[model samples]
Target: MKILVTGSEGFIGKNLMAELRNRKYDCIYEYCRETDSTLLDDYCKEADFVFHLAGVNRPKDQSEFMDGNYGFTSELLEMLKKHENNCPVMISSSIQAELDNPYGISKKAGEDLLLNYSNETGAKTLIYRFPNVFGKWCKPNYNSAVATFCHNIAHGLPLTVNDPSVVMNLVYIDDVAEELINALNGKENRVEEFCEVPDVHTITLGEIVHLIHSFRNSREERSIPNLNDSFTKKLYSTYLSYLPEDQFSYDLKMNEDYRGSFTEFIKTPDRGQVSINISKPGITKGNHWHHTKNEKFLVVSGKGVIRFRKINTDKVIEYYVSGDKMEVVDIPTGYTHNIENLGDTDMVTVMWANELFDPEKPDTYYLEV
Candidate 1:
C-alpha cells in the first residue's frame, strides 16, 4: 500500500512510518519543516492512504496555535479537495481537542475542517483522538506525563504529585501504533466516524511516583547487603516527603524475576544454561575472553559501553546502549570483551549459553589488567 504521511518528523509520525515500513508498505513522508502543499499533493496523488498529522501540538501563544494547527490543517484539506477521488485521509486529532484549552480549540477546528471537506468532496476521512501516549524515543519537551515520569525515575529524582486522587488514562505508544495499523488495514467503511482510542490502563499520579520509588528502593536493597539503619531511614524519609498526609498502601508490584542489574541470577535450562549479573556504575565486568561460549548482552537498565577486541588483530569495536532497548550485541567466541556501566544506576545483563555453566573449567580465559 502506498501511504503518504505528513508530520513524518514528529514522534507519532515516526512511529507510524516505522510500523508501515515493517509491514512492507510503500510510505512517502513529508515533514512540514522542510516541505509544504505542492509536494504533499504530488505524494498524495499516488497514495492509497493519506495520514494527516502535521500541526502544532502545543504553543505558548493562542495565535501561533491557531495558525500552525488550524490553518495548516485547513490548507491541507483544501488541497485534498482539489484532487479527484483522493485517498482516505486519517487526521490525528488529540483528546485535548475535546477540552477548552487554546491548543485543544485549534485542533477541534482542524477536525471540523477535515469533516467539512469530506462532506463537500465525498471523500473518505477518518479521525483519531489519542490520549496520553508514552514510550521510548519520546521528545522530552512535549509535556507528556509519561516522558516526564520516566526521565525523573531513570535519573533517581524525587517524584512530585500535584493531586493524589485524580486518575488519568495512559496508553503505551506501541499499543497506539497497533490500533492505527489495525484501522488502516480494516475496511474503509468501518472507520467512517471519529474513533476515540481509549487507554489500556488508568493510574493516579501518586501511584506512579510511589511505584518508581519502590522499584528503585528494591533494587538498591538487593545490591547493598547489611545496609545500616541510618541509610534505610533516610531513603524512607525522602519517600515520605513526596506523599500525602494519610498513610497510603502501595498497590504497585515489582517483577521478582526481572533479573536486571539489581536482580542477578544464573538459570540452567535442560536445553541450555543462562547466567546474568548486575554491574554498578563506574564498574567494569566480563573482561575475560570466551573460547566457545557465545553470549547475548542487553543493557536492561542505565546506560553503558561495550568494547570488544579481536584476538591476534588490532581491530576493535565499541557500542553504547541504554534502558529497555532490545538491541542484542552478539559476542562471537574467541574474542576478548568487556562492558562498563557509565550511568549512575545499575547495568543489568541476561546471558544464555549452549551448555551448563562451570566455574573452574569455565570457557572464559582471564587476561592480565
Candidate 2:
C-alpha cells in the first residue's frame, strides 16, 4: 500500500513513519516543510492512504493559523479529489478545536472540511481530536508543557508551572501510532462522530512535576519507579529519552574496602534489590544469616565456594562455583552462609536480595558457615 504522510518530520509524523517502516511498509511517500511544493500533488495522486498531519501549532501571526491548518488541509483534499483517489484519510485535530480561539477555530475548520469530503465521496476518514500527546522525539520548550518540563528537568533546569491545579489529558505517542495503524487496518476506535486513541491519561500539573522530579532523583537513590503504573512508566521513559547524551551514565555509591567494593545497581519496592559484589583473592565475605531476608548469589568471575550450614547442626553443604560455569546459590533462612574466593584473582558476584537493607532493623546475624 502507498501511504502519504504529511509533516513527515514532525513529532507524531516521525514516530508513525518509523513504526510503519519498522513494520516493513516501504511504500511511504513523505512530505515535510522542506519538501518541494509540486511533489504533494503527485504524492496525493498515488497514495492509497493519506495521513494529513501537517499544521502549525505556534504561528507568529494569528492569521497563519487558519492558512496553515485550514488552507493546507483544503489543498490536500482538493488534490486527492482531482485524482479521484478516495482512499482513507486520517487527520490530526486537537481537542482545543472545541474552543473559540484562533488555533481552535482553524483546527475545527480543517475537521469540518475532512468530514464533508468523507460525506461527499463516501471515503473512509479518521479524525482524531487528540489532547496533549507526549513521548520521545517531541520538541521541547515550544508548545507542549510536558515536553518542556521533561527536557528542563532532565537537564537540571528549573520549571515554571503557572497553575499547579491545571489538569492535562495525555496520550502516548506509541498508543497514537498503534491506533492509527489499527485504523488503516479498518479497526478504529470510533465514537459518535469522531475517532479516539483508547489509552488516555488524565493528570494534574503538580502531579506531573512530582513524577518527573522523582525520575531525575532515581539515579542517586538507585531506585526504579513503580512501572506497574502505566502513566508513570511512560512518563519515566519519556524523561529518560530527553537526558543529555553525556549524562546517560551516572556514578553509583561504592562501598569499598580491602575486600573490594559493593555497589547497588537497582532497587525496587516489589522486585527487591540488585547489587554487584567484588571480593579480593582469598577473601571471604558474607558470614551472615537472615531471619527473613533471602538472597541469590551468582559468581560471574573467578572461582569461589559458597558454603552453608544449618543453625545448631554440624552438616555443611558446599557449592564450588567458577566463572567458567556460572550458577546461582540461593541463601535460605536459618542457614548461615559465606562465599570464599578460591581463585588467584578477584571474584565478581551479582547478588539479589528480597528487600532493601535497613540499618535500623538489619535482619542479619553473623556466624561461620
Candidate 3:
C-alpha cells in the first residue's frame, strides 16, 4: 500500500517510517520541510493512507503554532478532497490539547478539522494524544525531558529539575510505532474519542532523575540495572543510546598479580556477580572452601584441571577442561577446590558467585585440594 507520512523527518515520523519499512512496506511518500511543495499534491492524489504528523510545538512566535498545526492540516485535507480521495488519515496530537494554551489550542483545532472532514467524507480518522515519547533517535535538550536527562547525564553534564514532585506520563517510541502500525491494520485502541498507546509509564520527575543518575553510575560501580521492570528496561536502553560516540567503552579496574589478572565484569543484587580470571601456564588459583557461598567456573581459553576435595576426605575429584570443549564446574559448600593451567598458554576462566563477597565477614577458608 502507498502511505504518505507528513513531517517525516521528525522523531515520531521517523520511527513510524522505519517500522513501516521494517514490516516490508516500500512505497512510502515522505513529506517534510525539505521536500518540494508541489510533490505534496501528487502524494495526496496517490496515497492509500495518510499519517498527518506535521506540527510546530516550539516556534519563535506564538502565531506559527496555528499556522503549522491547523492551517497546514486544513491545506492537506483540501488537497486530498480536491483529488476526490477519502483515504484513512491518522494524526499525532498531544495530550496538551486538553488545556487552553496556544499549542494545545492549535492541536485541538487540527483535531476538529479532521473530525469534520471524516464526518463529511465518511473517511476513517485515527487521532492519538500521546504523552512524552522517548527512544534512541529522539533529539536531546529539545522538548522531551527524558531525552534531555539521558543526553546530559551520559555526557557528564548537569541536570536541573525545577519541580521534583511533578509527575509525567511517558510512552516509549517502540510502543508508539507499534500502536500506529496496529491502527494501520484497523486495530486501534480507541477510548470514547481518541486512541492511545496502551503502555504508559507514570513516574515522578525526581524518580526519573534518580534512575538516570543510577544508570550513569553503573559503569563505575561495575553493575547492571534491574531490567525486570519494563519502564527501567526501556529507560536504560534510551540512556545508553545517548552515550558519546568516542566514549562508548570504559575501562574496568582489573586486579593483577604474577599469576594473571582478574576483573569483575558485572554485578547484580538479586542475580549474581560475574568475573573474568586468567592464570599463567602451570599456575594454580583459588585454593579455598566456602561455608555457604557457591560458585560456577567455566574455562574459556587454554586448558586446565579443576581439582576438588571434600573436607576431611582424601579422595580428590578432578575435571579436565579446555577452551576447545568448554564445561562448567560447580563448587559446592564444604569442598576445597583449585584450578591449575595445564596448557602452555594462559588459561581464562569465567567465574560466577551467588552473591557479592563481603570483606567484613569472609566465609572463605584456605585449604589445599
Candidate 4:
C-alpha cells in the first residue's frame, strides 16, 4: 500500500516511518517543509493512507501556530478533495486542544477541519489527542520535558523542573506508531468522538525526575534499575539513547599489583556482584574461607585448577578448568578455596559473590587449600 507521511523527519514521524518500512511497506511518500509544494499534490493524488504529522509547536510568532497547524491542515485537506482521494487520514493532535491557548486553539481548529472533511468526503479520519509523547529521536530542550531531562541528566547538566507536583500524561512513541498502524488496518482506539492511543502512563514531574536521575546513578552504583517494571525499562532505554556519542563506553577501575588485575564489572542490589579476576601464569589467589559469604568462579580463558578443602576435614577437592571447556566452581561457606593458573598464559576468571565486598567486616579467614 502507498502511505504518505508528512513531517517525516520529526520524532514521531521518524519512528513511524521506520516501523512501517520494517514491516515491509514499499512505498512511503514523505512530505516536509523542505519538500516542493507541487510534489505534495502528486503524493496526495496517489497515496492510499495519510499520516498528517506536520505542524508547528513552537513558533517565533504566535500567529504562526494557526498558520502552520490549522492553515496547513486545511491546505492538505483541500488537496485531498481536489484529487478525489478519500483514503484514511490520521492526525497527531495535542492534549492541550481543550485549553484556550493559541497553540491549543490552532490544534482544535485542525481537528474540526478533519472532522468536516470526513463528513463531506465520507473519508475515515483518525485523530489522536496525545500527551507528552516521549522516546528516542525526540529533540532535547525543546517542547518535550522528558527529552530535555534525559539529555541533561545523561550529560551531567542541571535539570529544570518548575513545578515538581505537576502530573504529566506520557505516551511512548512506539505505542503511538503501533496505534497508527492499527488504524491503517481498520482497528483503532476510539472513544466518544476522537481516536486515542490505547495505553498511557501518568507520572508526576518530581517522580519522573527522580526515576531518570537514579538511572544515571546506576552506572557508579553498579545496581541496575528494575527492568521488570515496564515504565522503568522504557525510560531507561530512552535515557541511554540520549547519551553523548563520544561517551558510549566507560572505564572500570582495576585493582592491580604483581599477579594481575581484578576489576568489579557490575553489582546488583539483590543479585550480588560480578568481578573479573586475572592471574599470571603459575600465580595463585584466594586461600581464604568466608563464614557466610560464598562465591562461584568460572575460568573463561587460559588453564586453571580450583582447589577447595573443608575447615576441619583433611580431604581436598580439585577441579581442572580451562578456556576450552567452561565450568563454574562453587566455593561453599566454611570451605577454604584457591585458584592457581596452570597455563603458560594468564588465566581470566569471572567471579560472582553473594554480596558486595566490605573491608570493615571481611568475614574471610585465610587458610591453605
lDDT for each candidate structure: 0.67, 0.95, 0.94, 0.92
> Would you list the clashing residue pairs of candidate 1?
none
TM-score of 1: 0.59
Give one digit per residue, the lDDT tens place, for model 4 in 78-175: 99999999999999999999999999999999999999999999999989899899999999999999999999999999987889999999988899
User: Which one wins on TM-score?
Assistant: 2
Per-residue alpha-carbon lDDT of candidate 2 for residues 139-253, written as tens digits (9 for 90 to 100)? 9999988999999999999899989999999999999999999988899899988999999999999999999999999999999999999999999999999999999999999
lDDT of 1 by residue, 248-360 (tens): 33332233433233323333234344445577778887677877878888767778888888778777788898876877888888778888888888777766666556677
> For each candidate, what TM-score against the reference?
0.59, 0.98, 0.96, 0.90
Provide the RMSD of all predictions against the true structure, rounded to 1 decimal: 15.3, 1.0, 1.4, 2.4
Ranking by lDDT: 2, 3, 4, 1
Task: Give the clashing residue pairs of candidate 3, or none.
Answer: none
- In model 4, the worst 10-residue window by lDDT is 220-229
CA shift of 3, model 2, Å = 0.6
Quote the lDDT for 167 in model 3: 96
How far does residue 215 in candidate 2 sit from its true spot (Å)?
1.0
